[model samples]
Target: MTTAPVILDRAAIDAMIGVIEGRGHRVVGPVVRSGAVVLGDLSSTADLPVGISDEQTPGRYRLTARDDEALFGYVVGPSSAKPFLHATGVPVWQGERTADGSFATRKPEAPTPVAFIGIRPCDLAAIGIQDKVFLNGYRDGVYGDRREGVFSVVVNCVEPGGTCFCTSMGTGPRASKGYDIAVTEVIDDEEHWFLAEPGSDAGQEVLAQLGAAPASDDERVRVENLLVDAADRMGRGLDTEGLPEAIKASMESPRWDEIAKRCMACANCTLVCPTCFCATVEDETDLAGLEAQRVRRWDSCFNEEFSYIHGGSLRPSTYARYRQWLTHKLSTWVDQFGEMGCVGCGRCITWCPVGIDITVEAAALAAAAKEATHV
Candidate 1:
């Protein structure tokens, strides 16, 4: 049965982790590493990035200390649920030479189920977008295997980063869906706790195990005010009304050439992006030629060889590659996946070497399209 809104004290976090572990899930959450908050194994609430916050802008990201001892005070760092769900360097299949002159091939076993904690709402949206990419058409066995029975706990964003624009993309500062449980952290002069609500049967059971108490009306109002403030504080926004059509129409815009001058084609944006799921596979054999394995690795459209076929690379120029990447992300992705590829997590803007903001580029293309329409 769906439970009422509950209040979980600071100690309840540790209890929640223990319960998830008790269920045989490898618990992972946000932790401090290399001076940044990234997803890692969680043994207790102490392992979380408590009292830490992040400063993110175009081409920069830094970890800073927060005034309060809020356990989840920081925004998302470079990592997301992507690496865990769609793992890289996975062996698709291995083949061995049999005694007689034949080859025996076998697919790799499915991965163990995992429980994710402290997931941001934008990342939850990103996971949904990836679900469409990997689970819809052919049903990728590897991603499907990893995605099964995975428990997700989403943490609402009450303090968005400088580069974040989830609100503009209709993703969030609040967890709308795709979570087993949702939490909103509250820290003030009086108390520090979480307002938790179950989104699924498993979540209700977990909260019951924690003995979470029913939340009061005051607590609910406080959380609503915090979330509304956070929404107003979003650092950037993209006007997506006619964005896809504008991007598709601006194929010949000179704005691409301007961006190409600073574009490094380093693929850092795709690597950090939660939804850019282009990948390529390779077959390798041992020196003895007795065994062979096919490996699937993440790829990027910015690479010159990515569009290469037998004859030559289709998009050799940096401008053409950039155009292709943006077009696919905002315009063509809707045609392919029924939605935009980006969830507005802002990882690309924060991690780009030259600070090439996708939102700015898209606006430029839209303006160019409007000017052309008037002519």
Candidate 2:
């Protein structure tokens, strides 16, 4: 069930920040750096990307200044909630052998509590996908601990980037879940305030601390109109009605070869994707050869060794590896997690050096399947 929202002018947003930090949570949110919105440590409202906007396309990203003071004028960039929740490189556990020929292992201390601010709906859905992977029967202690204490504040996108298609995925333009507080920023000629709503107990408590007033009917109407405008503004989309079946049917298509011609197997797509969970482990020893540390690092299916077995790799050719990645991400993932692996954040499209858009590839798969049916 949804709760009625409250209104907060731009000034009160800072108070909301203080409320989260007051609870000892390290606030992590978007910051403008190197001409793009990047996630980093945040202290106050000034730390947000104010008057900053971005232009995103396949294989390109450029940041431009907005005329107004709208903090979240742009949509998501390459970064997601993935980094803070699951570090790219983490030490799983370390061990040392004593003189008595015994071994002792020690796990790291629990992660500091994190408060993720300015999250978008699609990325929040990506977080949910990861939860099923990391918190299911076979749990990941590192990711689980970091995920447990997160205080999430989601912001609805009033405008969509050129590569955005969360609407096609049924994930966004408006925030839905996995957030404590959901806010809609409305900056127009007459008003410049946020329509804020709390979705959890912590959110309610924090919102109360901000001393916000009940949202007016006009304010609620403005918020709804913003979402509708965003939906129409989305420039890209993927028709995913029968995506899993389409991918399964298009395996023999020559599209794989076409993609392999351009894909460098750089693994940028997998790295930027919020839900790709493949990782590799390494064992390192000190100069004494007695003390050692076990390191776990994020890995990608694009690597040659990713599909290695006793005899040989499951996918030896470049085309085979690329196909495996696409198939798993769009098809087999649904079988394993009961949902599509993609959350429509467009990170893969924007970050890919070759501008290999997943939506384009998905459409090609459907065309290939159609040709096969005629054959």
Candidate 3:
């Protein structure tokens, strides 16, 4: 069902703030921090990152002022939505032993309901890919409990990043689904407003409270054009047509060795990746040896210990580990899940300590496969 689109002025957004605040939920969105746009808790419209834009590259990030006061001034940051849902340093298990050797256990606290505003379309797509691993495959109760209370208000990308390739991944520039409400900002000398569409009943209720006017056909056309323009500005892309087969064929290719020499094995790629889901559990005790707890943290296949088995590690060499990571992300992930593991957000490209690009790697493999086929 399609609800009529609405044009929301800045004043109308303030009204939305009241609606959310009245419902006893905190609002979090993008704000300027250390010369970059970051997702954080915000109280008012003034707290948003206005007149700012971010420039991201491997091992470098900077924020610049924009001519217009656009709320979503940047593409994405190093952090994704994962930290909000599955918290770091979470106490998975807490217990105390009795004198009789019996033990008492305490459950972890649940995450509070959060209303997230200004989420980008590609990020929303990344959340969907994450759900495939957390909710679909394993049905993680911790992630599920936190995700259930999330209310998302997605914002379309007005400016794509230099490493962004969401268009090639069929993810975004425009958010088609997975959000309660989708907003496209329209800014110019004369007009500064948002064209919003509600995808859920909660979103419709929020829109109704905002009292925004219905958008004109011309305004809708303009928003669509903005999305198209963002897509056209993409600076990176991957050809996924034969990616799985191509990656499988290139297992013995020399490209892996070249990359391994450059890779630092710092696991920054996995940390920044929106869909890399490997994790490890740890148990710890206090110094006095009175109490103990178990925790789970994010783990990466790049770690040398990740492939450890009974006798020896399966991926003993850096070349093998790098190959495993690239293959799992672009190739075997499709076989394991019905969809590609990556959303083309380019976080891996930006956060790699040595600036190793997955797109370039894919291109090299594709070219190598073509040459081998010709021979």
Candidate 4:
């Protein structure tokens, strides 16, 4: 059966949080942290980043005050849902020497269930990509349990950031799937409410607890119109018609050298990216070698040592590293996973010190391929 949309006022939102917490899950949502809006623990509706909007461009991010008290006024910030699900510096196992020169090992305890609110549509897509990475084929039990236990509340975009390209990626402006509950915030001179729809049985139960009234047809139409406006306002776009093939054919394109000149290879892009899931494991032991632990920490392809082998590093040049990163994200990933690795969140563009835009580089590659064909 199709679930009816519900209208949630400010008070109802607060009640919704309380109701979720009552179900033994810690509620996390967007909050003003330092100078940006980031996901944090929510004790009440007051913890949300109300009336704050973020301005994002290539190599820039800043928070601005919104004219209205709209709770979900901002797009994404530096953080995504990755840290909660695929955490860094996590201990995989610990070992201790026994009396007879043997070792004992044990895995860490399971993580707590998390209820995430105000997750952007792009981020929701990112989580889906990671699900394939960790939960497909061999399947990572740790990541799977945490991810499966999440109660996600996706907030569709009404105001996209300057670097946003989710619309072009077919990931967002408005969420289509992978959320327990989705909401669109509407605030005007006369009304301030959210048109909420449940995507799962759990979401339906939570809404039932809030006792939120069903939304009218006019309210739903208003939300659809606003989403359309948001899609049209996207700051960037990528033509993905033959993107994977074009990127693969541009293996020797001079564009790599051009991009490498400005590339720092500092791994900031990979570090901030929600879907780049490369990691390295390290084993540590005490001076006496009595106790030791194996830790799995996040790694990046931009690092020189990441490609080190017996003789030397495979990708010794900056151009080679940059090419590898972009090619894998846009081209090779599709071959491996049957989906592109990027969701067009543009965190890499906003956080890069040199402000390198992936969409621009991808477009340039496609253009170069087209010119070559003509010649």
Which candidate has the highest lDDT of all?
A: 1
What ranges in model 1 sit over 4 Å off? none
Give the CA lDDT, 0 to 100, for residue 42 in model 4.
96
RMSD (Cα, Å) for all candidates, in order, is 1.0, 1.4, 1.6, 1.2
lDDT of candidate 3 over 1-375, digit per residue (tens): 558889998778777777876776768788777766667887877898878787877666678788987776688887767777765667777887778888777877776777878888878888888788789857886678778868888998878887889998999989899898898888889879999999888888889888788999999999989989888998788998888889999999999999989988888998888778788778988886667888878888988778888998898888988888989888998988878888888889987878888999998998898789889
Query: Could you tell me the lDDT of residue 35 within candidate 1?
Result: 84
Per-residue lDDT of model 1, residues 15-47, tens digit only: 999998898898999999998899999999899
| Of 1 and 4, the candidate ranking higher by TM-score | 1
Report the lDDT tens digits of candidate 4 across residue range 1-375: 358999999898898888888888879999988998888999887899888888999999999998889999988888899888888888888889999999999878877789998999999999999999999887886677678678998999998889999998899998898888899999988889999999988999999888788998999999999999999999889889999999988999999999999999999999888899888889999999999998888888988889999999999999999999999999999999999999889999999988999999999999999888789
Model 1 sits at a Cα RMSD from the real structure of 1.0
Task: Report the lDDT of model 3 for residue 322.
Answer: 85
**Better model by lDDT, 2 or 4?**
4
Candidate 1 — which pairs collide? none
What lDDT does the true structure give each of the candidates? 0.91, 0.88, 0.83, 0.90
Clashes of 4: 0
In model 2, residue pairs whose N, Cα or C atoms come closer than 3 Å (at least 3 residues apart or on different chains), thus clashing, are: none
Model 4: lDDT equals 0.90
Worst 10 residues of 1 by lDDT: 137-146
Candidate 2 runs further than 4 Å off = none
User: What is candidate 2's lDDT per residue for 138-214, written digit by digit as tens?
Assistant: 88987988888899999999889989999998899887888999999988666688999999988998998887889
